[model samples]
Target: MYSLHLINKNIGKFYENIPFSGLTSLRFMIVDENVQDRESLKNVLEFLGYSVVSVAGYTEASKHIRAGENYEFIITAIRSDSCMDFEKFLLSVKDFLEDSSVVIASERAEESCFQSFENDEKIAGAIHKPYKMEELERIIKSVRQ
Candidate 1:
């Protein structure tokens, strides 16, 4: 026999009660110094269907943030040049309550840096350098949840 085309007649009823219900719009940014890394991350985030913005360094990232924009996630790597003051940038991010997630890519296993940021009570996670795409997806999903 042919497959039954059973439709959930009650599907539309699911939206009946909730006054505020919609697909969670996820917006995020990537702040990385290395051109390759920055671009690669941007491409991956976009591929994963996120509203992504990117900056090359901390200064640029700060400018974007100060422009009164909002983002649900922030993925950053250690600064490479003077374009962004890394310390100040980190502090600013820590100050934002809506900053749901952050993943810092470091060059080495300096768990101290990760620990320090995570201890801030806002920072959610950190991804060390040379991570796999799967890792990124996992972290992003965790943040969204």
Candidate 2:
């Protein structure tokens, strides 16, 4: 089971300005290495009225997106341990939409991280590691806008 500490912190902090009110069509995917992180993100997104799916790493993340469906949001983590390039993982998601919203999470989210995808406008934004649920909500709302 995933830890609830981080997720509990985000309770009630849903994105208020969802581009589409009611957002019945907002589907999200949370891709991260840690089971706890994935579960936490899934819970938070679901609470905010989004239909969510989750995967543990890049491999599964790619599979889910490649299943011939479109998801409104993708929240992923940079996995230095997985031998996969974050850029490549993101590229795999490009077939979905040119304006897809992606929120990348990293343990050390330095400005250099932003530099990596600066050329690719599809990458909506990033989240630093050890994030609270509220922070995730804010990022999602900002990126969706």
Candidate 3:
């Protein structure tokens, strides 16, 4: 009993009526030592409608985790100047996060490194640096699923 125009209008209104929080409730935490790379990734993710919090190193990230800030996704670099043992930092915080996916991103990450954490349930995935937006989105979607 509705015309095509009426149906389209209703659909638009339905979507517009939805709250931002309802539409995007997925929270993300990004940890990287490179300022440019960290901000660029954060901007891209935010533009794509995901809530993101970026930190320069492990210490800041640990503070958030310790304070019980729950992030659905945690994207971190494999190496940092301040955090000598990046893998150890990730493993240490695994217990604090409840059902959160930890994705490692680094230019030097290789198949061997991924293989090492393949058995670790906390490690959701890995992405090499210089990745396209599509590649990053694909990884994020896969981890959320």
Top of the candidates by TM-score: 3
Error of 2 at 53 (Å): 0.5
Point out where model 1 deviates above 4 Å: 1-24, 83-85
Better of 2 and 3 by lDDT: 3
Q: For candidate 2, lDDT tens digit of each residue in 14-123? A: 23332324555678877888776677667666765679988888777777777765677777886732756787777766876544577778778577977787677677
Give stretches of model 2 more than 4 Å off: 1-21, 80-83
Alpha-carbon local distance difference test for all models: 0.62, 0.67, 0.71
Residue-level lDDT tens digits of model 3 in 13-54: 211121122326788898898886787667656755779999
Best to worst by TM-score, what's the order?
3, 2, 1
Q: What TM value does model 2 have?
A: 0.75
Better of 1 and 3 by lDDT: 3
Question: All candidates: CA RMSD in angstroms?
Answer: 11.6, 5.9, 9.5
Task: Please provide, for model 1 over 56-123, each residue's C-alpha lDDT reduced to its tens digit, 9 standing for 90 to 100.
Answer: 77777777777767887777785545744556677765555366566777768878767767765556
| Candidate 1, residue 36: how far the Cα is off, in Å | 0.5
TM-score of each: 0.71, 0.75, 0.77
- Candidate 3 stretches with Cα past 4 Å from truth are 1-23
Clashes of each: 1, 0, 0
lDDT of 1: 0.62
